[model samples]
Target: MRKRARQESAFLNIPYDRRYESLYLAFIASLCAFGLRPRATIEIPSTKRRLERIIELIQGCRYSFHDLSRVQLDRNSPTTPRFNMPFELGLAVDWALGANPEHGWFVFESRAHRPEKSLSDLNGTDPHVHDGTAHGVLRGLTNALTRKIHDPNLAELDSIYRDLSKAARKIKESRDGSLFEARPFQDLAVLARQLAEERISSLRS
Candidate 1:
């Protein structure tokens, strides 16, 4: 039963910060649009052991997306580069090779060949570059998951993002809070799923 669920879900491993908010939203929207359920550690409550929870998510989801774009140093802190994204990507790669070679994952980057400079061990592997934009992320995601999802094209993905953004704004305005907050994020996922269903229905009609 657990294996089945894992096969049906896709785990999202991206930087959890305001700078990545738009890309994150675009990823979620694109996944939902193509009928894939997106899961992330953010869905877990803060009270739990986060690392353990993240591992659990990685183990439970057959498909994972690791965005290695934000490996650079933070503007506020000149010396300290963020390593969480690559760290989790490493974990996922290890798990796939050790536990299940069939488990598939994609490495995402903002610029071409950037991952090679930061994580040279992944030299032979290719990452989908998003150019640090919402549209780019959507296109990268679509191309990466081409085996599982039909191509929605950039125009269709843009349409979905626009619709989802409008719905997300309504939710934020109604709640008067940050959409990335736990509850609001959950609501946004629900709304994305609803919108995806509506899209499918329209296509069928």
Candidate 2:
């Protein structure tokens, strides 16, 4: 039973394309943002190095549009604040996921209890225009890959994920919010991998 559980958990960490109507929309949106025409499927490498490369490319492109340096945490707030760049990128991811829930390409859990941030919260004194930009970037990147794979359904899933992430960010930013407890997706991936390794080791022991 433990082994099965561990296998399931590990499987979650392995990224795969999803199947949903919104996913296709996300592909189109992403292509538009990246200035690329839609293809049958976005090509992505199956190796870890390739995955990291894709993520890095997205992260690099994401920082070009948003200025995260001035992101301010509410004073007297206990929860650690999300920097602007990461925050914006996160929002993009949620929106992309939300846009298409049917696509199976996105593997992250969009429905989990999230940090309680909403669009209103993030739209503080300054205009949160970059929220859309970040969203666009995510769409663009997802499209770039999905087009190669011939899956258009992931677009909507990416949209939804971005929307949920925004909500989660607002919740996490709040004093009573559990944002601080939230781990970076990369960190969570690492932890999950380690947990799986440990679980496997225990069986052998």
Candidate 3:
């Protein structure tokens, strides 16, 4: 089994397209606020096989957040539906059940029971719905994690979001209005970690 501290890291599986950018940011910020390090495939370099990299991340992290909000048909390709999120969720679930039953996972969808249409196997499981909005993501994430982690209260979560928004705006200004690039994403993660540490310290003091 992995060390307890190492298990605090959370692997995030969500859509990578621009449409989910805000929800992505909210997820990152919410995880940091709960004092968890957020890990994603984005941090991996292009030199490695993507599947291998994702598996490596899942193995390293003790918890995972899987969002199946975009499993519908593609706008340009109506007949084809995206399955990356569900595919990753399956991987994580298998690893947790087989390797470490203690591993944790939270599934999020834009609509309740929608995942059942695409993945009937998950019929009875309740996925937190986020309504495809950033605030909804924040709320759902907070509720999902609070039971497992030492999470902040709802008001504190709101404060963390406010701080994240300010930090993101600063990063965007510094980057000449280009904020989602690799460097900016790294900076945002660093800022979130720092903010989380500060909050914890304040609570302790």
Candidate 4:
């Protein structure tokens, strides 16, 4: 289990709102299609401070995917910029720099050059830009993580994403809350892995 966890699990650090729903599901599908498991704070059991829980979760995974597209100001009251994504990215960065140098973290954006403008610290680093589309997310993941064998194309990812979207709708309709809720999120991850596995199996057969 330890070896499998280190080899397959990936900490997903993305926005958890309706606007970012498509990309969220895309990330799950793409990661699973690439033969990886996706982990998030929602599925992490409650223990101590949320930040600590986040760090612990990151420690468990060998890779992390961060989407910094929603760094702009919030539209609702107070109108403050959302920093959770970047803040968590910082946690992953620190962990990669100090404790676990093997931890791999990838940054993604909706616009081409926005990441550079938003975070000057990452000047030398290139954040994969997905242009806020589901296909874009898949493309970014393909570029970020290579799989010489079992590699998936946009069509395969689109199929998995559509299936996940249908499943997400059913999950939300049957459940009492949003997709961001703990149970709902966990359900999506589980279903994604299953569907992705099925897809890969079919390809092999």
| Predicted model with the maximum TM-score | 4
Best-to-worst ranking by lDDT: 4, 1, 3, 2
Where does model 2 exceed 4 Å of error? Answer: 1-132, 147-150, 153-158, 170-205
Q: Taking the tens digit of each residue's C-alpha lDDT, what string does model 2 give over 1-205?
A: 6333221221011111122222323323333232222222023334446544444433323121222322335456585554434453454354335652322222121222121233333332232221223344353444334333223333443543444444444444553533222143333223323333333332222
Writing each residue's lDDT as its tens digit, candidate 3 over 1-205 gives: 4576556689988887767877777887778777777888778787889899999888888789999888768879457777888899999999888987877888899998787787888888789898998888888877787544456766666667678878887787898876556677778777776776676553233
The lDDT of model 2 is 0.32
Best by lDDT: 4
Q: What is the TM-score of each candidate against the true structure?
A: 0.89, 0.23, 0.87, 0.92
Model 4 off-target regions past 4 Å? 45-47, 202-205
Per-residue C-alpha lDDT of model 1 across residues 1-205, encoded as one tens digit per residue? 9878887678888888767878888988887776667888778887899999989888888789999898877779467888888888888999999988877989999999887789999999989999999989988877887643444667777777888887877776877746666677677777777767666553223
lDDT of each: 0.81, 0.32, 0.79, 0.86
Candidate order, TM-score descending: 4, 1, 3, 2
Candidate 4 per-residue C-alpha lDDT over 1-205 given as tens digits, one digit per residue, 9 for 90 to 100: 8967877789999988888888999999888888778889887666758877888889889899999999888889989998989999999999999999989999999998887789999898899999999889988988898766668777878899999999998898888548887788778878887887777763333
